[model samples]
Target chain A: MTAKTTDRDRDWAAALAAANAGDARAYARFLHAVMPVLRGVIRARGRSFGPDQQEDILQEVLLAIHAKRHTWDPAAPVAPWLYAIARYKVVDAFRRRGAAVHLPIEDFAEGLAAPEADPTAARDSAALIGQLDPRSAEIVRAVSLAGESTAEVGARMEMSEGAVRVALHRAIQRMARFAKGERG
Target chain B: MRTEDLIAELAASGPAAPALTPRGTGLRMLAAVALAAGLFLMLAGTRADLAARLAEPLILTKTLLPAMLAAIALPLGLRMMRPGARIGRAALWFALPASLAVLLWAATFARTAPAVRFADVTAFALSECVGLIIAIAALPMVFALRLMRAGAATRPRLAGALTGLGIAGLAATGYSLFCTQDNPLFYLTWYGAAIAAVSAAAAALGARWLAF
Candidate 1:
């Protein structure tokens, strides 16, 4: 079990390192790999939450991880950092809903072995995206939901690919901020 | 949105800018200190005896104490910026300088004649001393908060308080050069009050601004 955990950590760390070095495909793989762990952890700790609420927390955690990616240290194991962020967001969600719970670090280890569950569409994130300006919202929808490339989205929108990418990035950041209750 | 779709979008967002290193944090802090020092010098010129006063223990303590606190707080604040980072014994390290300040104050309080002790505590520009420290710290506090915002501080209030403590230390250190009050009682009261005020303000601000 220890060896398996070590191997998982090594792979996740390597993928995240690659992602930091600008490998998009590796980044996608890393995110996909961590999703189950995050979902399990959230579900375990947030038992009071309904499935939709759990997923909302999951999505918020994912957005936070993306926005704060620079806080991760490549030299350190990814698990602690990943679990810390997940725990923080989970605790935050609970706090916002006016409840308190304890989540020991041991729970994260158990979360690793949790059964994989399909993700449902989350409402909060969708609402945040809807709150974004029209152009940014359209670009985000095209790129993520439609799975279109930046180049494709840009061509359709009559903007440069770089412009599309920047818009999308800013939109994601704005959504994260909105999730945290920031205005403008 | 589906988690899978969200992951696809995040992955497509491209690589983040490089993670900030301890060295980078140090450099930015240094820049903020240098700017604050420049402002301090311009507004309140250094005392003429500044060179000679360095040899005096009390005069030196005034500067060294805050400098020590700043040194401790800079790294502590930085560590708090990372997610899941345990503060451990680092939090305890603050006691060293704090104890030193209290010791110095006690020693001076004991030696001074009772008739002069009260006068000593209130002898100088009490409001100005605190006002100057806060003013000096204003820019650095903003800079520190910006740096904290760039990182992911889970304990935003504590992190903000640390930043305030660190910036106040640096500001007080710079202020000591221009401040002519040498009484340990006066410096300790006003300087301590000023640092506390800055830290409290930072704590309040951090609770709001440092979220996420």
Candidate 2:
């Protein structure tokens, strides 16, 4: 290989190694290094979602690159592994935020309701809810348990009813997220 | 390969996310099932008539205590699951409403004079304050999952919601056992299901503004 090409390759190798070693500074370089590819995949996915969402997708990927660094197999090529994650994250973001997408939320809803009827769904359902805010946790109860109107509930709780509605809506969506044991 | 072909080749060659250790998955699933089991205890307990039951055990004041516990512990449990990110913390701060807002809403809705009762309002506000802090601490977990990169099934939104549900669900179940005992169906039909449903809804909405 030419001297420039060899040096560039060595630089990437060192960057990847430092990232794997838990070096935050090096990881930032790693994130910067991967940005072009990340943006490319995002842009390739299309600009249908507003620029903000598209940017969000990229940000999500960068954060993922940071958080899941340990999961990378040192033996594997980094580019494609990252590319897939970026792609999946963007698609998920689109589905999640009601962003511009080729498919609509209805399609997602249909799939989501595929029925988490494993009988054990309830048991599997609880811990996930623990991850949200307590008031949100309360809102989940108010709307679901008390059957209070969202507006009344929100007002009583001192929040916008619409915000309450949205919070409950997302919580349900999250709970209904019973996987078909596919992620194994 | 051409750029597109090269990219496609790269994509095709990517490996699956590293498997969470069997122990880790077991821990996660165990936590889920354990929570579910704990919740069932509480859930079944709430099936009694809370009013009549209240007569038996000072139920009115203490029955809802489990619910309160669920509110606090639930968020703490959720926060433990987060991967730690700046935006995640920010999201937690934004999630809790000001205590004044709750007072205003209560005044507007209740027939009681808005100006009169000091103790009850103070108590409620204090609990609200406590609840909000607990939530703030735990709230970050939900967003942290989001801020961290996702893998196979650990969608940040899903993770956050489930953690919240698991923590809150069991506690709510326990609360129902205590408070709604006389009216088990009351809590089940209302509170238990309501929180779960609403939490899921919030997670869904979260997919919007909380993106990336």
Candidate 3:
């Protein structure tokens, strides 16, 4: 099924149809009209592709459209079909390079998952735990903020592993309630 | 090359494209088939006992099955010559007549004694028939390839192979007229091989020559 055509798309279709009918000027105009938009399509895939790669893909799309111009259905809108070829060429270039540029999961994790020692978060945690008694605050900070194992916190606090885990769970539940209360 | 230069070069040509007439292509293909048939008749001649063989259904099927394959494949090959047009699942219909021919071959083998089956498949015409069909196919294949070049084929190799199949079918039909073998097995094996050989050769050539 075809999408609704815009005035811009109709202009392209008319030019291409005219070009098919032996109008050289119209064919040149059609090529000129599409080049910028085709460049934009390739550019919009982001900077993972270098300038040379983008140019290569753009030339490929233009060549394909030119070579296969007769195959385009004159009744259909031109823009989508042309962009589809550009997209395919871009993808082909990416595949040919063996690997695509991608931001790794760790990059996003660093951006979104605030580190334990983030100053603002650490201050907030300190304020929240300040409400606790000295022993509870020490246990919460060692096990949660400081990223210590339960057994290590247990040994440091002179308690069993099970006891340390219970205390850590209660500390998290209390911190959650306190935060929700502060938000409310 | 720069897009501007490419555009200028393409537009500089007298016409954007030739008047692609599918009917004209179909006629040329038929003419090529006829020419190949005439050549085959001149070289190998038609089978003797022509009236008696025509009376037999199996013999008639052996002679005409390859023609049926051509009838089916020719239209598809012409359609595929157009860029962006696909053979699609509809091309699978080519196998229907082919499968029927294979079934006939199976029945022939089942009904005949093993010793006779061996003799029938190994007849003097067995190998010669393949050679004759390929010989007859050469002209039609060239015609089909030239016709293919007139259209912009996206998948040149596939289009070339399809044209080869159609042309080979026509060639096999011509060869069948001269092929005297009564056993379906011989026609099925040798004819199928000749068509495949042509298709493979055309596909290889198309890869090098058919792209727009």
Candidate 4:
């Protein structure tokens, strides 16, 4: 690997290790840092997808990374672990749409420097939230869409911050399940 | 929702528990084997001459073949649990024990007189052997699938098949102790059939359960 790639992997690995140790800021930083790489890879692979469809796939990748984070070994390099999930989600999106595509592993390395952009519009994931219980839907929307902190949402909902976090985690997990075509 | 918003939500969800290590997977697999052993002993004790028979090369081969298969498949199945991890050369390793068994079967079949070859193959309790092997495998297959589900398997069907193959190998090992049928012609056909059935079932189930 290149020196730059080594540095990026080291940073991501450390951040993810800290994130797993309960540092939310580190986790956020890790997610932000990886977003451009993930976006670039997704865009390159799913060129036929509209902007919204691409975002939907990106959101699915993000949710999968969250839900399956426990599958990543701390001692291993973060890039492969991260990109594996990205590739799986991208391939899954293609399969769901009745298309078959073969993505070369090297494609991910080239897309690492691609620019990140906001989704043109909310789509599948936005609709998935409505399937959550009313309280969970509110908690997810308040925290994600309105940019409210867990503490703020907890206070407004008369729940503990810890409870809010648990609820949000469960809600996100359910959304992941829903996205994968699982029923309640 | 915007990508940034999704990132915020995931970040706030807090850290996940540590990934399940290879050692953890090994321990769970051992526990499943223990459970299968318990079931095997309860339902069908070892053959009367098992202690003496174990010293015989043919008797030992029956047990060792599946045992070896399980040993190799455990790591391969664990690799399948990871999203992008390639099983690489470990997958090719399966051919070692597999070819050994097939060659042994072919040699044994050829040496037997053609007239009696059919009798030798059908001499055992075919239904009982197949049923017992599957029965021994059933619970362990569930445990293996559960463990597979806990990880992010990108190739769910393949992961499931590997797990099933491993579990069936263990189950077959246990069944070998109870099975007195020493003929390679008999054990090879029925045992192979049972393992294939289990693998296929797991592959179908994994496609549905391990998708995430």
Q: Give the local distance difference test score of model 4.
A: 0.81
Poorly placed runs, candidate 4 (over 4 Å) = A98-184, B121-124
Q: Which stretches of candidate 2 lie over 4 Å from their true place?
A: A1-17, A20-44, A47-81, A88-184, B1-156, B180-184, B201-205, B208-210
Model 1, TM vs. native: 0.77
Question: Per-residue CA lDDT of candidate 3, range A1-184, in tens?
Answer: 3344587888898998988888989988998888988888878873665564466568777777776676566766676567655665566556643221121222324535776534454454556677666777787767544556667788888999768766765765565566556531
**Model 4 agreement with the true structure over B29-134: per-residue lDDT tens digits:** 8788778877787777889978899999988999999889888877788788887878887778988998998899999988988877667455348887888899
**Given candidate 2, what's the lDDT at residue B186?**
29
User: Highest DockQ among the candidates is held by which one?
Assistant: 1
Error of 3 at A42 (Å): 4.6
Share of reference contacts kept by candidate 3: 0.32
Ranking by lDDT: 1, 4, 3, 2
Candidates 2 and 4 compared by lDDT, better number:
4
Complex DockQ per candidate: 0.57, 0.02, 0.18, 0.54
Which candidate has the highest lDDT of all? 1
Counting only residues 3 or more apart in sequence or on different chains, how many pairs clash (N, Cα, C under 3 Å) in candidate 1? 0
- Per-residue accuracy of model 1 over B1-212 as CA lDDT, tens digit each: 56788899999997787785766876797689779877778877998878899899999999999999988987888888888877788889999998998898999899998887758444348777998899989878877787778878888898888888988988999999998889898898889999999988988888888889
Tens-digit per-residue lDDT, A19-104, candidate 4: 88889999899989988898899899978655655776888888999898878888789999999899988888777632211111
